[model samples]
Target: MTDHTINKAVLRRLLSYALDDPKKLGYAILLLLVASLADVSGPWLIQHFIDHYIARDQYPLDMVAGLALAYVALMLTAAWFRYKQSLQFNQIAISVVQRVRKQLFERMINQPLSAFDYMPTGKLVSRITNDTESIKDFYVFVIGTVLKNVVLIAVMLVVMCLLSPRLAAVVAVLLPVVMAIMVIYQRKSADAYRTMRDLLADINASMSESIQGMSLIQLMRQEQAFSQQFSVLTRRHLASQIGVMKLNGLLLRPLIDFLSGVALLSLVALFGVSGTELIGVGVLYAFISYLGRVTEPLIELTQQLSLLQQAMVASERIFGFIDARQQAYGDDTRPLASGQLACRNVSFSYDGQQSVLDGIDVELPHRGFLALVGHTGSGKSTLASLMMGFYPLTEGELTLDGRPLASLAQSVLREGIAMVQQDPHVLSDTVRENVRLGRAVSDDDIWQALEKVGLAGQIRLYDAGLDTRLGSGEANLSAGQKQLLALARVLVARPKILILDEATANIDSGTEHQIQQALQILRQDMSIVVIAHRLSTIIEADEILVLSRGQIIERGNHPQLLTQQGHYWQMYQLQQAGEHLHKLEESAGVPEAS
Candidate 1:
């Protein structure tokens, strides 16, 4: 969503999301209002005791005792109400935040691959974590405080008017003027906060990229370059925060001075005009107390206005995500059949300008094996993405068992297809838990998959067996070992269609042999689609598709393609020559691709 759209829809929905919790929210508001009411009566009690009991030179013991008891009872009740409200609001606010966070996370988790392509991971992280916390500030601090001050303001106004309407009139007029200033400041603050959030995300993205590329940076002796870039971003972030702080400072001091000056002026005017003893010392005392209480709301409103402005910016970000076309909703009308896949004039594009797969047509019957061989940037991975429905086809159709893949629900589509990415992601969990992925898999099934991947013996050799935790990035394992673990994860899923993107490319020959054995075991049940750079690996495929640029240049069995002397043939010959030259180099004390 655009920035304008984010502000409009996101802000509205955030308020609604907050209001959804009504029971505890209602009790909390009621308690806060009651506490304010009781506090408001304090000034009146002082006025009554002073005028009728003390200043009248008639200090009756019973009257004094009654007033004292009443004051104590009100204070006690107010204290209890305040306590209850604080607890209730705190709990309710936390729950509301968690609920909104859960919904936001679900939206992101289920988002299509296209979403990730457009939005940066760092920015998305900021929205889910940082933006949600800003909303919490609105809930836990801003909302309750705003309400309490407003009620106190209202009650104080009533009491002030009862004492003298002229003073009350001055106060009421001053409030609107204060509100006007707050509104103007709030708009400016919101804009500043929004810009600050976006800038912060950019800084975070830059830092994250730099850290991930530290090895490359070191290799190129570009550490100074990266450090200078980071320093510039750091300065930008600090400047944005300073701007917000300055805006807040400017608003607070002026509002306080203005409101305090107005109160002082109104008191002076009221004192000067009074003729009767009606507005005497006691009345003046209570008026001063109420006047002080009156400014509490104005001050609170000003402060909350600033926080709410920041929250509005956060809400805009959060709501934009929630309201974004929720990927593409799945069609749950039918279940997936077999794993047969067919593409007819299918085309997809990351950018609208260049198609990743243009006018591609192919057929893979159920339980049939196919290998996609192409030079880098020949839409191999893009084809895998399309097959998995991670990206919707921009034109034409892809079908599974004569049913349009788009028509199948996400759950069903996923149930039918599984992919082992080129660089498989291993979570920070135990080896077994990573494989199960929170699913309740039988021990027998786990062992079967492990054994099929030829990792069962390796797992048994480890001290913790299946329960062994894979350290961060699986840092404890060799690259080949990590690849075997990734294959085991895929094997555990036992999917109908398995797409391996250079699954064994990083593994040693010994590990590759194990993987080959696993594939031989898996081929009977699962249809395998492989995107391989190593032509020798896919030499036994039922059919091979050679892609150039974005279109398929050739498709045939290995022997048939070799006779054609086309792109596939050319790539094979290059591999052959490279292997022969490598063997020669190896005899002369260099490594070779054996």
Candidate 2:
């Protein structure tokens, strides 16, 4: 029952999309009605040509020629009308798909980061691209096929009645049988199509994961295992596809064709038994022709039942995603006046239990530098996420300048605070566009930002210079270069507060020195927050906080923390020793001086 209601809702939404340009759809339907009328007239014309002249002893060549010409003109007229109607239908379908894809992509991207914690990237992408395409197929194939067949059937039935009411009634009896076949097919195929769509999404998810992690898979020598896993998924998908085909074979073409034969047989038997003076040869001929035409539509309509099922399931999935949690943000749009930030008794949890951060309070003045250090799972990244407004705090106040962080508009906060992640995503767009990020910044500003990050010279060597596009395999830049590009992206914004989540971890020492120098210059104006796995990077910070199990255990400058010999001291000593060992290994890795 719920599925029925959801299907109804999906149909209504599709109807709304079709109705977006009502004038085009209305004209198309009108043309289709005309085409159906013309189509029905063909058999009547043939009946007239047969009984009026050919059956008679007199065959006037002019009249026969006239009938032939009329037949040709009628065929041409129907073809033209159908062609125009199909064009309109296609246009509307494409437009609807474009609009739906835009809305769907907007919804997908606007979701909170936390919402994606449980959702796979590929599954969401499939919803936006693949599922939306299923909707387009409904409009393009199912709607057009069903509407044309229905109009043809309706017109044929009316002509059948015009010829002989009794024979029309016989044909009408077959309507209920066609409907029964349709109902049975729908019942059997609904779950099948739903399963197919899910399996397709799973297949897409698996492919995306494999592609993204192919290097790791190869390095780990798990290629054969991954292939076997993919084979299993594909086999399941194939089984589902074959199941649908079996349904199509059983209930759609073959059974409907058999039913057509049964209808013809029934009509012929009834006509012979009731050999009355009420109907003539012409009438019988027209009835037979109409019966043939009507069954074709019944067959077509039954075939489209599977498509209708697939579209409804796709719609349900799409609406489900759109209705899920959207990132809740405040409407406050006020601009920042200071770089001051403070966290007062802040606590947070992902599942509303077992807090990840608890009772953490800290403050940073304008132009101050603060660093957070911890082992894995110590909430360092979570706190950074909060500072960047990626997720709302679970408890306590995180304020920017003097205002509550959550109350500030995302745009305002984003413009006032910038973060460059360790491995930032570069769009498959030009370098200038990447740095400018759709902002109103000039190319000069982009170049200046790049220059500050010490990547200006390296980027200039590209053939397209600022216009060079980058993504996945197209990016010729190294990992360290991409980090600099990210820093350059943020530098163009010149935010008041900068959060660096180990942004320097991937860079070599020379580039890291350049970035550190850039950060030092920016520290004269902007307050900076750094989350570091490398202890040496934060040794010169104004203050450093050492965290464990969601609470700060030590807070001080580097020298002060060393004196305390606490978690910070232990971590720094370990990193220093590791670096020393790495240098020795590097020395041993090469032959002595020569």
Candidate 3:
């Protein structure tokens, strides 16, 4: 879009946020009008004292004293009105910002999982935090400043015209020129502001990456390289700031001062030539006072315009994210009566070009354990994500108990299905809270879930037991303990279908055995799907599917697949050999190398 069109669109949207609470906006406007009226009266009052009391010298001392007292009262009243106006404006601005920030946060969280793949976490954070903060300035300062300035200028112009039409015409002529300068500054600074914002996001992203991977960077001795990269981004950001500074210096205060000087000199020359009959001393003084008042706000208005431009750029980025079409959640709310799941002719792709899963068909009976054994790129995890409704299929029919899975509401789908990943996040909270996941579950339910996962005994050793706070990174727990805790989290929900996606891939054999025992208990009631790299864990599965390059190359129970001597057989044989070698080493008293 053209700069003007984009700015206008963003400005309109920003104003709409304020319009949400029209009563507050209306009150703010009323106070502004009152303030402007009081402001305009100040100069007129000065003119009245000069013309009627000082120059005429015809009024009594008491009358002049009364007028002076009235002026003081008028000034105090105007100050009160101005104070109320600012207070009202601030309240409205804060309300708008709170609403926008809340909506932006909600939209970010509700986006599809796929959306996060291409957008960096740090950049998304910048939009929600930094960008939103910039927009806050637009509401709190820019909106109020612009409105107040316009009112002041309009009031001054009317008073000026009444005093001298010729002088008012001069100001009217210069007004457009000053505004044109502001418009030019806005257009020129747009790209610079956008670049600054982008550079800030890059810096934030880099910092987040470096912190998250600090150990990796240290191991690889790449600290200096990352530091240099960060420095370059900051330098670019600094350059953009300098560009904005130059624009502000040139167009804002200096330009307004020059125009104000020209107006004053022009007024002098007009009165000097036209004589006292055309324009009196008091009238000239009042015009000069009005001129200073009018041009001063125009100067501030220019600066506010700069802020408005930055806010518009931020608004564009924020709105762009909020406008992204999220994954659709259908209206179907039918309860899952059974754990039976089936997929027929299912095909999918991440980028819509290459196939990730092709013509796949699978079925799991109620309370059955179905395992998916596959190579690294064999689409096992992709299938699990599809089954969980994380993405829509390119071509397929997936069903839960004969109901189309794609037609189910997200809440319904989540209620019936749960997946445990290889790497699960643990929050920095009490063990009980982590398991309950903010649900209002009873202490008995949390303890039962932990007991089912075989973690209750370990937890009981701690002084605080279930209430013990887990350290950041779950440092208090072992890898196996974290996996079991994650399982406990899912168990608390009591989903009808459970998917264990390589959950034991990183744990020890003993821990795997414990998880297997837990799974044995769970499988008696829920349909289970396990995607495993270690073939030994799934040997007892009712059915096994071997996948290669997004297609199932073999399908049968573990014993039947071994009889075929296919891909599953080869994987099982390799794992068996590795285990045998390890057992031989232990029996021979060989110390395992770290």
| lDDT (0 to 1) per candidate | 0.79, 0.86, 0.86
TM-scores, all models, native as reference: 0.93, 0.95, 0.96
Tens digit of lDDT per residue, candidate 1, span 163-214?
8887677767778778777867776676677778788777777776777788
Clashes of each: 0, 0, 0
**Relative to the unseen true structure, what is the C-alpha lDDT of residue 56 in candidate 2, on a scale of 0 to 100?**
73
Pairs clashing within candidate 3: none
Ranking by TM-score: 3, 2, 1
Clashing pairs in 2: none
Candidate 2 lDDT by residue in tens digits, 278-320: 6657777888888888878888888888878888888888878
Off by over 4 Å in 2: 1-6, 471-475, 582-594
Compared with the true structure, the alpha-carbon lDDT of candidate 2 equals 0.86
